[model samples]
Target chain A: MPYNVDAVFQIAGIGIIVAMIHTILKQMGKEDWAHWVTLIGFIIVLFMVAMLIRDLFQTIKNVFLFHS
Target chain B: MIQVVGLGVVATILILLVKEQKPMFAFLLATFVGIVIFLTVIGKITEILKVLAHLANQAKVNQFFLETILKIIGIAYIAEFGAQVTRDAGQGTIAAKIELAGKILIMVMAIPIIITIIETIINILP
Candidate 1:
């Protein structure tokens, strides 16, 4: 299977946008909102990684444990 | 391989750009790219192991021994990947603990082979 390079772009785009929002909010003097934005961005990226990890674990199980 | 390296380079650039303002996100980006790279190469790893197993079978090596060795290697790689990711997230203590667990698991898995070796040595002596 070919690697899905788009996923990397998608994640990086989210990170960049979130960072932008955070800086904008902080400049506007809303530090609390800036922090929340950063947290949300982190959680979104985390969810994506969590799914990838689940897939990795399943592959590992099939590869290492149940030798067909 | 080239594709994976390109992706990593792009991710690294992005992470560097984001690190100043959002260090947490930068760390997450690094971890995500690491896993993505691993996943992309996993198919190649499986293919290589299958070829190795076939060669071992042809050479009259014990299948069980080959399988155990492969499993131990898999555990080591997975555990190292996990620990490194944890360390990248700034949890050095937890990373060390993960390494300890992997070593313990490897020792447990190797016991049967160790016993076989010892038994063979005993049989050959005097």
Candidate 2:
């Protein structure tokens, strides 16, 4: 409905935290864990975006009368 | 209106902050903000279209033609939004392809309108 200002901050926070964890893990010689952390963080953000996109497309189809 | 501007500025600042550490997140944030802005404005767009449709009906315009035109407009808007987002991510080639696809689809939708106009013109000449 309204603009989601919180989502912007939430994503930024996740990115910062993920980057920090990744660097820390790499420094500790756990490259695999670092990659995993990045992957998981990306997937989380992707899920959030996927839901938003779905809503967007649905609204478009309804407004434009895309019966298909 | 102010809210949309505020959201854009805030998102831009946040994107910049995230870009230094994670460029991928920056791109996703850009896309997320874009979708949010579009979603927020869509309601207003629907209201405007409703008013236009009501006016068209009062004027006895063909409903099928109006529907086709609206579909064309929607396709253009979607294609432009998608291309701009893709370009924001530095994929100029993909953005161009998206635009091309949109143009073709719009032309396809406009074919019936074009045929109708041609038919009207031919009938008037007789």
Candidate 3:
């Protein structure tokens, strides 16, 4: 996984946005929907991260056994 | 690398500021920051693995040993990740179980290497 400062910032930005949305939703008396939003945001960020992590694992496995 | 840590600190501050009435938000922020830190380090892992692979091949080490090491590392990472996520999700007990499973998997993976080393030493003595 290539560590780009930009990507880190992007994730942080997403967090900020999620927090804002969560707060707004809760205040509007939609707690159930707020929690769902939080969960979806978490999943989305993780999915983006999982993509890079997958590459790292592949590289490790190939390097260890195939020298590629 | 430095930037990632800096971001984590910033996120920590933000979490602290928001956590009292926004516990869920705080948890999500911390988790995201953690993932960013993890991704930053992953950038370095590829080069390290490449070097290790070159040396292992040159030294003619057992491929199985490499496989075992890789598997153990995988278990450790997954278990730790699972445990951390559970903790963040406010389920500390599940984290403990995940960590326990990781440790057991690592031990199981190491047994063959330990036995091989012992056998090699005995052969050398006789």
TM-score of each model, paired residue for residue: 0.90, 0.96, 0.68
- Per-residue lDDT for B33-70 in model 1, tens only? 88778888888888988898889999999988988888
Best by lDDT: 2
lDDT of each: 0.83, 0.91, 0.71
Task: State, as a TM-score between 0 and 1, how close model 2 is to the true structure.
Answer: 0.96
Give me the overall lDDT of model 3. Answer: 0.71
Chain A TM-score, each candidate: 0.89, 0.89, 0.79
Q: After TM-score superposition, what is the CA distance of residue B14 in candidate 3 from its true location, in Å?
A: 2.7
lDDT of 3 by residue, A3-65 (tens): 554654565566677778889999999999999988887787677666756654564454433
- Residue B29 CA error for candidate 3 (Å)? 1.9
Residues B1-126 of candidate 2 have per-residue lDDT tens digits of 988998899999988998998999999999999999998999999999999999999999999988998898889888998899889989999999999999999999999999999999999996
Judging by TM-score, tell me the better candidate of 1 and 2: 2
Chain B alone, TM-score of each model?
0.93, 0.97, 0.84
Where does candidate 1 stray beyond 4 Å?
none
Q: Is candidate 2 or candidate 3 better by TM-score?
A: 2
